[model samples]
Target: MQQKISDQLSTTAERPSGRQASSPRAVPVLTLVSHPQPQRIGERLLLETLANTGRTASLSRSAPEFSRPGLPPGQPLADPFLSRTPVQFAPGTRGRLRLLVPKDGTPVRVAEEPARGAREFLPEELIAGVPLVLAERVVLLLHLTRVPEAPVTQELGMVGQSESLRRVREDISRVADLDVPVLIRGETGTGKELVARAIHQQSPRREGPFISINLSAIPRELAASELFGVQRGAYTNAIQDRLGLFRAAQGGTLFLDEVGEAPPEVQVALLRVLETREVYPVGGNTPVPVDVRLLTATDANLEERIQRELFRAPLLHRLAGFEIRMPPLRERREDIGPLFLHFARQELEAIGEAHRLTVTDPRAEPWLPAALAVRLLRYAWPGNVRQLRNITRQLIIGSRGLPHLRIGDRLEQELTVDPQSAGSPHISGFEDTADPDELSPSRRRPADVGEQELLQALRASAWDLKATSERLSISRASVYLLIDKSSLLRTAGNLSPEEITRCFHECQGNLDKMVQRLEVSRRALQRRVRELGLGGP
Candidate 1:
């Protein structure tokens, strides 16, 4: 556990500013990975270390008890779905854990494989975290983490029990009072802007207005004036003098979202501002001093953009006085259940259906099944929490007046990865030891796959042609061939001008979104957009 868990957290002895320490000390805990009842998710059981041989898990009050903080302490699993016969977990020396699955009880699956009678987990496997599927009723993750931190709050407004997010919180607390510029980075919809707000709300500037603007959404020509104000009569549309976001956020924070997309000239202006604490209006020569705290966020790979000469290196350095990274939702699957419920509760309340989640009878079947929660947990979540919110909203609306959350027929199929097969083998930071059978879906001959499989593959791959080909274990050419043969599939060649034009505006000239909407090759989509003169390079 010492070596492996240390590897799990950090490489070197020095703890990176926004990362965890290299200490081998970690607490082993069992997280309620998923449940039909969403509130129970993320509850954990903390185990003692080898010094105390860890706490032995056993049944209490006729059911296996898992707590609000973790296993072994507080709450009880009074739910009736669990098998009465207890599954005993005994801890041994040097971080070893022995499990005894009752003969009459449903076989406990460890990392998706059934443990016949008894099983022993080595320290390394426990450090990487093992998923235990109990009677198909609930999922639990047995993993090591640093000591518990404070829970999510109204002020911070982030959710998760993962140590990674804990480190993020620590980063926020450490920097909030320093008055230093902070740069946030993460995948889209991973809540980089939310983190920026958290910083602003917690900082000394909390009383002042926290203004935020998306640099990418503003036109290139107008970006400078938007950020640094416009002098009256500067342009035909400049009917009056305007105070830019810098002055508007005086004595507070101005969060520049999508800072990587800042225009070339705007980048130079930003660098000047960072160095001088001043801004020059669009038509004025004199620089106005600013007293606002600067925070910026981006999901782009600015280093790559710098290589292309699209962004200035000096600006990148200035924006990144201190960097905080928001880990994607997939990296912390345990948070998925909590986050989904958090988002779902709002929609459910809005529709006046809040009581659907409340359970009066323990014997009654849960409206939201554990199996469906597993599917949600196993999803890739490329669009992160924002996409999860959309899916939650979809379930709430699409299933209005239903007995349960009626997962759409299409979404049900798309999320149909086998319970025993998907996401059981690996955690994000651990080494990949994926089963060969995991890739078996691709082993089926491309010709044998039906139109249904093609569409499913396209959806799963986010309409990426190369990824789709790899998913089916076929060549790129075979994917194109399948598209040509399928009557339902559409490519850029066959797309109507009106459709492309509509998609271009709706997606705001984002090619990736166009690729997803049109279900066509990205390169081909770009060519068609250009040929039609829709917009963008």
Candidate 2:
């Protein structure tokens, strides 16, 4: 009677969330590839939804233990490789196996019990592999066939597989077909120009030239002539007729970077161009027609600048026909590892070396250790993707040809020196160690060096790490490590939740200003805001 009841329950639960069950005679088999661990792999598996509740089952050749926490009762466990072990499944046992396999072109086979027949599973099947329901309970982690790697594109130089990145790509594709202006807002180093280029490349204007100009780089006096072609003798030093960015990008796209930096006069000219699709060159009477699509990028809060009357409100409305915000590196931490690998490969290829270095290789260089990747993911990366790429290049070049390398050891040596010795000898805490003759007679370090002194230096340098490091005569890494250890990077004083909220509001939700005012690290301020339930901008 008990056996019958058990069988009935299994049958009732056999029906999946919505789909019909597979043939009863044909057991569901999942063959997972062995290379690129599942945690790091990005391939989507069939019937993955069914395994949502399934837990990883520990399996090994020795001792073959089956009874464990979360294990389904009365499910037959079998070792596919062990001939003596019989594989049995309860009437409605549903199971899914996650296997790791190699990417090299090779076939994988698993032996079946009783019949003792070996079945081969192809790579394509594993790539779009589906999970099976053997019984109500039964999930296995098996070693099986490998899945082929997903193809990567070098176009736009955007590297990431996270959902955030996918959405950005989708946004770029959707907007590429249109001629409307686009406004891209992102933190520094987030690749706004690359995104603009991608849109241009995908647009109907791909045959036309794409021109980019940094509004901040041009002098306020020459902004108009620089953007719109100038007539000869327009002004002093206007010796030749010059085609400006607007005319140069005539049929294509014009990418204006740091658009927020445009002067008020330049802003008015931009608004006119957008409104009339025409530009007036400096000292030129006729309006030159321009058919260029405009794409603008900025790291600043243009809305705040407008509120302060530093930017024109009308221009903002015209420029932002479509807006896309690129997420910072900290928000898409999962992409860091892959991006590091991508940058490393690019660097190696550019240097005319083999670009086959694998992160999984046990013999990989120390500076490129998997742990460093984890640390990088945790870092705030204030400078974002550009900083990561620069750091990767530095590490690769620094550690090249070294038989062994350990990042932790090097960082410790650089960061663990006596606090006083880390700064200049003229500082109060530091004792003069260098030769007197080597030191300039007129130059002197600060008489007092402490947390207060460091904070002052940081303020004076506008929180520039390199400048702060130079002021203290310490390595940049040491400065970072010291700042982190002493908690000097945190907001200076403890404030009530209300006070913190007030400060955040006062800063117009600008986290950078909040950091500066509070003398805290950006991460610290972000955390405080979260704890106080003060949502960020």
Candidate 3:
């Protein structure tokens, strides 16, 4: 029985990497066992396909050494319990099979030659086990076990179980300990800053301050003083010595957001500081040393910016010691439901109404209906996670007393409406109500208002929600809901690039003032400016 089993399982194996083949006709064969089934038994099943060719699978409890650069010594790439050895099949061979079995002490073997047929062995026929074959091929030993439980980890304020997010978390873990500059790239509202904070919190600089700034928010003329500090008499308005972001973030991390919007001169200064590990305050000849881990984020294409001479190549190289790209919400739709629930719970708790909403099971009670969830998933989240959170807050607040907000029909109806007629009769029922907060001071609600009129009122009110609400004779919550549902809110208005530029100058490049003058949201204005290639003043 042993000789028959050996002959049946033997293959024309090739020599192992470091050894010579014992027989010229021998082929390499590898054996691997799947993690044990849910039932606990110690029997290893031999996969017929793998036994036909002699090649051993290579499984390790950690990520391969070659894939783990910058990882601390002795640190496993992933959870050891869940890790599996990778198997490499030779050319023309089929991929590996997921074979699993228990320790039933059954003798198993594959036919020596290929045949398109299945052979079954009775339990009593394979009582005696065959000896382990010693071939020139490498044999990787693996003990199959149940799927490992998720390891306890600091989720870093991120809530997602998608593969993309998992990879991001792993990347963060791998590079967190290294004191190197990191560049985060993602579309608008993808939470680049959150990733940066995670890195800082995981690093040695966790105890130090985390200073965050938006480069686009800083005017070109003020970039230098705002970033590297200003002497008491640096400029006409410099009445006091101010420690800028660099010094403020000493011994910690400095996150520069929208860095692609930085002016040419500021880019040069940044490159200098990165190279020297020091900063020269505006109007000061002395160079001040700063120990700050720099992290940068942008939605712009820096490589294109480099081609256009808008950004410095050396600075880009300096900041991008490691690059992490955050996947957009549309790409990770599976996370949307969980994110909505998380935000909804937080909103409910904040309003002291957690008990009013059912939280035990997501599939039932106060949670969004399945149809609404499907609608949400189907919609392209151009605004990403930030937009999702804002929409969730609006939904929760708007659905005050309802036992459950059935959004399927309402959302679908809103989707079919023409965006240009944002103030049409579609949302007619949301007018004056018994709630005092919903009542407008005008008492006479505006009727038949269109998108143009709404835009004009928003502009006249300086983008102030209260003022806009009053002008439209609607409740503040309704105004927000309108903004959320209206595509017109995001579309470019009648203002031309030249007109926006003139208004920007008139407002002295103050973004708030510019938004008010343009009658657009700050995000819309910035996006327009970027689209026009105007480069904000």
- Specify the highest-lDDT model's number: 1
Ranking by lDDT: 1, 3, 2
Q: Which ten residues in a row have the lowest lDDT in candidate 2?
A: 422-431
Cα-based TM-score, every candidate: 0.71, 0.54, 0.52
RMSD of every prediction: 10.3, 19.4, 22.4
Question: For every model in order, what is the number of clashing pairs?
Answer: 5, 19, 24
**Which is superior by lDDT, 1 or 2?**
1
* Model 2 error, position 309 (Å): 0.9
Model 3: per-residue Cα lDDT over 1-537, one tens digit each = 112222332334356685655342212222221111101011222222333443332323343321111223332213223325432221111111222211221122221111111222211112111111111111121111111113426578797654467678888998899999999998788999999999999999999999999999998889999999999898898999999999999999999999999988889889988999899999899999999999999988799889998888899999999999898775554456567767777887887767644433312322444334434544546577997898778777877667654454444643232222211111111111233533325543333556677777887877766787788877544454455444356333334578877876788777777775555555556655655666664
Instruction: Please give the lDDT score for candidate 3.
Output: 0.56
Write one digit per residue (lDDT tens) for candidate 1, span 277-374.
99999887888999989999998879889999998998889888899999867557666766876777799899998887665565555566656665
Angstrom error at residue 412, model 3: 5.3
Per the 3 Å backbone cut-off, how many clashing residue pairs does candidate 2 have? 19
lDDT string for model 2 (153-198, tens) is 4335587644456567878887998999999998778889989999
Evaluate model 3: give its TM-score: 0.52
The model with the greatest TM-score is: 1
- TM-score, predicted candidate 1 vs. hidden true structure: 0.71
Ranking by TM-score: 1, 2, 3
Candidate 2 is scored at a TM of 0.54
